[model samples]
Target: MADELVFSVEGPTATAARQISLAEAGFTERAHLQEWIIQNPQVLGEGVLIVTFEFDRWRNATGTAERDRLDVLGIDRNGTLVVAELKRGAAPDTVEMQAIKYAAMASRFSVQLLAEAHSSYLSRSGASVSADQALELLRTHTGYTVDNATFRRPRIVLVAESYPPIVTATAVWLGEMGVPVNLVRVQAYELVGTAEPTRLVSVSQLYPVPEVESFMVGPRSRGDSEQDVGPELPEIEWSESDYAKLRALPPKPTVQAILDLCSASPDTAIGLRVIEAAAGRTVFGARGELAGLTMLVKGRFKRRNWPFSVEWGATNGVNQAHYRMSAEQAERWISSAGNLEESPTSRLRSQEINDFGSPVSPAPHKESGVTPQ
Candidate 1:
């Protein structure tokens, strides 16, 4: 009776089970995926892709005191430092924090990595650059020489199949604090094969936080909450003195006004190409420098954080302008101007223009006294 019960029972899934085992052992290994990510960053995330160097290579090349077990250490075009942490299973809660730390480190001393990247770029291009030549090129290309102090803030990105609940919560909290964090998901599939030769299919996709928020909010929010909230309207307020100061200045609206205008018109060229605010004066080039009219905006503009805007066309030349103002002020500006104009205070006295046009210096209004944020 015992020998008769020892007969084996096999199902169709038995062979597939064996393939799954092999795939888990071979394809799911972290090191293999890590190497793949380094070679093909498109398989992980988007933006400027890069990778961390080998321990000895990084140490000998940069003398950096870092030992990050991540995929890359670099910066994106928007000055966002990339701290990419990859995972085989899921994105852990601590991955976000670890990536933040790496970002902070990169922000402070990114030149070390930039140097290596530049060297690699030159090597790939089959061009040789001397120390002096590299320095000159960096300055010419990047607008300023590489410095460690003015370090831009870094952003954290997690690469995994799915982010743990804790990671999602932490990222949302950080976003509220103005810290940029993102998640990238990599999906793996079992391609058609038997136990003899198996194939693992994989694809990576990025999910920005905004997209996540939209998903979580669902279609219901699309009709109600979204319309209720509307676009994030900017606001600005100016005191009587601020108004008087602006009025006293030449017809030049403050640099803030120019910025405010430019912010409104991303497609136009009337915005502040170069500017400074605070002391109530701004110099910006518009209407084409060849047109020989560099509009100088100047005056005390409240709420420096509000984005400025502008409009440009053949009929209006540089066209109408706009700045963030109170709802009431916005209505007032719209009502009074009849034509397109800026907000906060629509009526401008020529005296305000003189104030911004004529500096408190002997030299030709060389510098705007407003300090940068």
Candidate 2:
């Protein structure tokens, strides 16, 4: 409600607005803003609708009607079609209507048409991406699905400092009708008297408090609610007998079990291999087998981030001992016992004296002080 809301292709005049759009500060300083966004996406959350490379262009319409100019066309993460018209400076209320007209044009377009446009944009920018490749990459990077079954919605993003009250009210009302509308306010700020004021900022959707909260917090709460309440029953209680059963079983191949189940080749080697899921490529490296196996176990367990404890014991003639041990201690036992020739039975007994049947002591690692040229 402040009259200080002056839109510009520069920094915001208010501190609150600046923090919201800190990353999107400069708009007129060439097209660096778009590049900054694509690179450092952590600045914004996944819900962001990215519109890249906007320029004023007009295209003639086809058929019996007179030809008309199309305003803006953008592709969303799911490759959803977005047709928008940007209005800068003091524009007429009619600008919103014109944006709707552009959206209508975009709605008539086939997915192939949008795909071609995406490909062209990437190509002109010298990016090595084919049409299919671009779509695939965008799908993964943006977490937006672009299938025929997905509902396509038209978007109208009004980039201005302020909108008329009617426009604001209309956008909200249309939003209820399934139309996606975003009124982004671009404002300018100058640091006076020793304040560095060369920055440009954009405060997107400053007004409409409830809508902002719904956009940020609503999705997360819904997801949390839908999540399983977790096991209704309490955890299993193990006694000394249970510990003896595991100790007697011996350390079996965890990773190898997965590989065998998946029918993966046994010759795949046991060293470190960085497997890329999308590319289906694995980079291999060699180190002590014991160390690599231990790291793999630690990495998998860390992902759980669960709150629980596990312990190990030794199985001897008629006597079974089990005690609680920390995660670190269990891993150490496995490393020591898992060797080329060591059998599970021998390792189990050795570990009882060595500690809860962990692997083995790893070789000491030295810090490499050498620098590469």
Q: Which candidate's lDDT is highest?
A: 1
Across 197-288, the per-residue lDDT of candidate 2 in tens digits comes to: 65545445533345354445323455553323332222333333433343344333432222221112222211111111111222111112
Superposed Cα deviation of residue 163, candidate 2 (Å)? 1.1
lDDT by residue (1-373, candidate 1, tens digit) is 3111111125644322122332364655356666666667554344344423321122313343344444565443223446667677666678787777556545544444455454554555467643333422332232222344334666676777667788888887887898877776655544344455434444434445345454454345444633234332223453334434543445434443443433333333431222223223332222122111111121123232222223222112221122234444333323433444455422333223222221111111111221100
What TM-scores do the predictions have?
A: 0.42, 0.45
In order, the Cα lDDT scores of the candidates are 0.42, 0.39
The C-alpha RMSD of each candidate to the native structure, in angstroms, is 14.5, 17.9
Candidate 1's TM-score = 0.42
Off by over 4 Å in 1: 1-25, 28-31, 43-46, 51-66, 110-113, 117-151, 193-198, 204-206, 209-373
